[model samples]
Target: MDTDVISAAIDFGLQKLSFTEIKINQRKVVESFLAGKDVFFCSPTGSGKSLTFEIAPFVFKYLQKNDMCIVLVISPLTSLMRTQTQALNRKGIKAPNKSSLGDVKEGKIDIIFSSPESLIGHERKLLLDLAKKNFIKTVFVDEAHCIKKFGLPDKKKKKLAYRPCYGRLDEIRSLVGGHVPVVALTATATEETKAVIKKQLCMDNCSEIMVNPDKKNVTYWVHNLPSDDICTNFRWLVNLLRGYKQATSRMIIFFRQIKHMADVYEYLETSLKHDAYIDFKEGGPNDNRNRLFDMFHMKTDDDVKDFICTSYMNPNGNIRVVLCSTSFSMGLDVKGVDTVIHYGPANDVDDYVQESGRAGREPSQQCNAILLTYKRCLGSQNIFPSMKEYVKSKTCRRAFILNIFKTIVEHAHIPHFCCDICRLSCKCACSCEDECVCTNTCNQVLPKINTAIMSNEDNDDSDDNDDNDITELDDMFSSDSDSDVLESSTRKPQVIYSSDDEMF
Candidate 1:
């Protein structure tokens, strides 16, 4: 392994790029790439999966100063492609947009970004020609699950979005030859989908790394929206947002269908608007129009980017709630989203993971991901089996989700900060080593559990004497505690409740 090269690559990522820390799996993926091994790795969305492959060719070029150490990246969405291209350029990598990909052949560019259709249709010969001479050092497949998503042909009427060329991705590998390494990365992939992705991408003997997809900082729950009382269900959200200071807190409401999204947006907009306490002179904040926005596939790429950048990234920007579809999910990383609401069940668990992963990108902030559903969506033919199970499960919500992905972490969060099921049933909410800090992010969607004082086995009030009275306990736990016994209790508790928990 090029140890120095690898170290340099990691440094470049942390210092030049926005990556925060080194993930063990990310390092291993980069090492495998440098060693000329095909790599297939899965980590949570916000974990910076792109850096694993990007660093390989980057370090390769840095080590030998070879402008021909080029990499070809096959991305799924055009929005994602544009986002990455700009990010790469920010770090001084010569990754040109699709319009300027012709420069790749002249060694002026270090990376080439293309969609499956464009790669196979337009740049097929250029890539193949580059591969013939071994100039293309590595091939990358971002959001590799798209091969199964847009590629597979259904027996029923094909949706216009279907593009079977995704299944033909192996042709690019076959033509490029096996001498060049291929790296495939995704935030969500099941065991079955894993086999499919490997076979489709010709990653028969690739080195694989799988990280647990659970995000501890983000809590999870499901809210049943009764069909009979639409206003009642919507009023709940309005009340929750009413308590939050929209400037610092953010929420994302996702929809399976655009029609329903519009309806929900209209209701939320009208409700969230500044209310006159008594038909006041004006209103509290009629600026409600600026408080919400909508994002969907219908919007242009620039519009989507603008929504994300200004609404979430820009502090002065006013958008605190977003009504959107799956279009806002994939590869769109937004930090500090305090809540995420799914208006209905997603088509599958993978889609759920991608869409909900958009929230809580900031490590310091806690997010609550709530899936709102009706009776029909629970058992719908289009819904994934595990997704349905998730809505109905009474056990640990995080445990159930981890089981779906076959991932295990040494420390599962205590019941209180875990999920609705665990919070309601967990006998050991205090088991987590870290002090649990209730961020107040999940009050409306999930129940809160206070495990500070253990309950008596006999359910007796005998142990609840004056010393241990609730009033005194509050003082002990309060910020200004000065008592010797309450010194440690003064600091706020911080049990994260937590893949793409940012990958879309």
Candidate 2:
């Protein structure tokens, strides 16, 4: 590594990002990029993965003897582009996202961020025109794993993939005319996924800088449920919040689909008002929200769930929760988010790892990654081997995830608490240095959601009951029929639902 590149990392850290020092891995990435290598980089969240792009302009100016350096960033998410653009500009670095190529020629903007579609769209000619003039020094593809999952959506499930432009990213190299180095970076990608990115981005001569994707302070927990429905599996999550009293911890609940995300986001807001709580001892739903809130010393006057439903970049201590989708995974840098809840099966395994990696970013903040879903994740026919094992295997969840990117460590990596499996088996007992380790009895420290409740969820209709549920059904089924016919039909499905049917 060049001494100049090493000095650049320190200079940018101390003067720009306000850090005492940069990591060795971070320094190496900078060195490789500045050497004009098409770099394939992968590291976990909170590892300062963005440092390479942040200090690139400084390194370019230092190398080329130029006053201004232009770096174009091709990111898949719009929210990520906006967040990075805002943060950079606020730091006196004039970076433009979703802006014209006019800014590039103006010679004031240092960094530019955009979605793949934008660069490949009508703006392609303008962007290529700028690249032709050597106005854009280097091109960056942040969250590069998308190049595999979204770019090449499987033929069977092509509709699930929204950004097909990721597959077409190879055109970017031709447009830039091979002068600029395209750096592909992401937090999660298996060796197979890496190969896909390399071919898609045309990084044939790319050097690699990969690191372990395991987050030490983060704990992983999976609750295999009976059903995949949002209302069914997410009950425990609701109860976890209902029973939670902590004001310091922040959370992000991720969903792959927008409808499910909206449904749960809306439910958390109105659940307290609708007596959504279940009391197995007392049997069925009841409104004990005020009692529980008072017990937890929770804030009642504030609209806690009135968090930014759309953009989830800013971390507010007052906002306890933010519901996220696949797009928000890359750019979410909220410092205090210590709890990450992933609902449903991830269409792509990389998205699951990336989304879960968002929590516990701050060194002092211990976080939890809770998986609430059924056995199967998306990618149904072609699931990542390790992801399938990690979900079902009763092994060290931390090690299982780490091996995805194959984190090379000097010795066995000791996590703060290995994971729920390791904790229960006392396998993590040796991992933690403290004199005492949590026994299997310590599950109380975590929430106990009755996932099997879907099997036991019963509607006790009294003989006097004449609610409007029958009307909600299609008219062809029961609009003309008497209430007795509807009752008979409802009972049949309830029997199947109540049975020991975990086939899903």
Name model 1 segments beyond 4 Å from true.
1-21, 155-161, 228-232, 239-245, 270-291, 314-317, 426-504
Candidate 1 Cα deviation (angstroms), residue 86: 1.9
lDDT of each: 0.64, 0.60
lDDT, residue 115, model 1: 75
Off by over 4 Å in 2: 1-20, 97-101, 156-161, 226-248, 274-316, 374-386, 407-416, 427-504
lDDT of 2: 0.60
In TM-score terms, candidate 1 sits at 0.76
State the displacement of the C-alpha of residue 141, model 1, in Å, after optimal TM-score superposition.
Answer: 0.9
How many pairs in model 2 have backbone atoms within 3 A of each other, for residues 3 or more apart or on separate chains, i.e. clashes? 1
